[model samples]
Target: MVSDRRYCRWPRSSRERTCISSIGPLLQPSSDALEKQFDSWQLRITPVDYLLGVADLTGELMRMCINSVGNGDIDTPFEVSQFLRQVYDGFSFIGNTGPYEVSKKLYTLKQSLAKVENACYALKVRGSEIPKHMLADVFSVKTEMIDQEDGIS
Candidate 1:
């Protein structure tokens, strides 16, 4: 684990988690892959770190799903929908057992999962009716809902 990575004030403790966080897209939101990442990186990932990393992955998944929808790729969003559902389920089990920070991240993760689901729904339901050129515009505007909820610009 690189000692340079920072997360709030838990600097030293977040090293492994920081490494895990960077591998989100590479793992494609798979918990198994996350474990593999810890092994590959020669670091031990705690359940809290793993869950936090997965929570971070959901944000990436949302971006990918929204981009896929704009690009008119139906399959990607569909697969993302399933992946997010699994992540959500796994996270639900954590419930209130996780630390305060994990709870905060989980809240954001839920919002991201919801946005991804909505994007998938649009792709499977209303996507065909919308013109291709207008797809990007629609998704760009709609994805702001996520940005708004997350307080991202």
Candidate 2:
């Protein structure tokens, strides 16, 4: 097992430190493969399936963010944002053919992720704690919007 003390070593030179800092967080395990799978699945799945898959993936992404925080890895937030954006872009490729309910839910999900991304950006810039309430609000809004849009009223 990788020890918690095992950190990626940055170069000693000041110039190298500047370059490393500018490059941002190093990618973690399986991120590239996951993105590729997400892309391939998005292309093949039906609208309903796509929405469901995205929702599932979103949940996983959130968990990853939390884990990152717990592990003192701030870079995960940026990765989450990038993953979310890719998910959104994948959905966009499906156009207007999705069920109205799914479409609306997806939109709400996107909005919630926008909030997360903004929060992460703020955290990255100012180094703050991301509010638990914000994450809760996103999930609640997503559930409410999905139900309402799906005529579950």
Candidate 3:
């Protein structure tokens, strides 16, 4: 068996995580593809790093949902919400047993999912009442109010 110390050389720093998160969307590779690429380049990454990068992606997806809504795309928010729910469900299976970095990202992931869900809820319930052009603004204000109430900001 490989010793745990062999894995210790992989940096757990936030800078490394930020780099990993940025690269993921550009290449958009599957996990297997990423593993193969890393092997070819003689680089190492832990499972926890992969999970953290995925968690960071939820925040980007949340932004995409809001931007798509602003651009008058009514379908993207629901689609993103569904995707985020699946990711959240997957993370839920990991529970509190993950590394501290992985566990910490779960809250951010949940927050991203919540924002998408809120946008979706608004679109569904008030689509008829609100003008299409103003929908994004309404969603932003509603999200901000929720953040304030939740003591997040």
- What lDDT tens digits, residue by residue, belong to model 1 across residues 71-106? 766676667677678878887777778798787877
Output the number of the lDDT-best candidate. Answer: 3
Predictions in order: lDDT = 0.66, 0.53, 0.73
lDDT of 3 by residue, 70-130 (tens): 8898887887787789999999988789888777888888888888998988889998898
Candidate 3's displacement at residue 62, Å, is: 0.3
Going through the candidates in the order shown, the clash numbers are 0, 0, 0
Write down the worst ten-residue block by lDDT for model 3: 1-10
Name the Cα RMSD for model 1.
10.5
Regions more than 4 Å wrong, model 1 = 1-42, 146-153
RMSD of 3: 10.5
Q: Kindly list the per-residue Cα lDDT of model 2 for residues 1-153, writing each as its tens digit.
A: 111212232233424422111112322334468677665322222557546655555655555565455455656667667767877787677556767765665665575466457547555654654454354344345446645664656
Clashing pairs in 2: none
RMSD of each: 10.5, 13.1, 10.5
lDDT for predicted candidate 1 compared with the true structure: 0.66
Lowest-sum lDDT 10-residue window in model 1: 1-10
TM-score each candidate.
Answer: 0.66, 0.46, 0.71
Candidate 2: Cα lDDT at 134: 51
Candidate achieving higher lDDT, 2 or 3? 3
List the candidates ranked by TM-score, beginning with the highest: 3, 1, 2
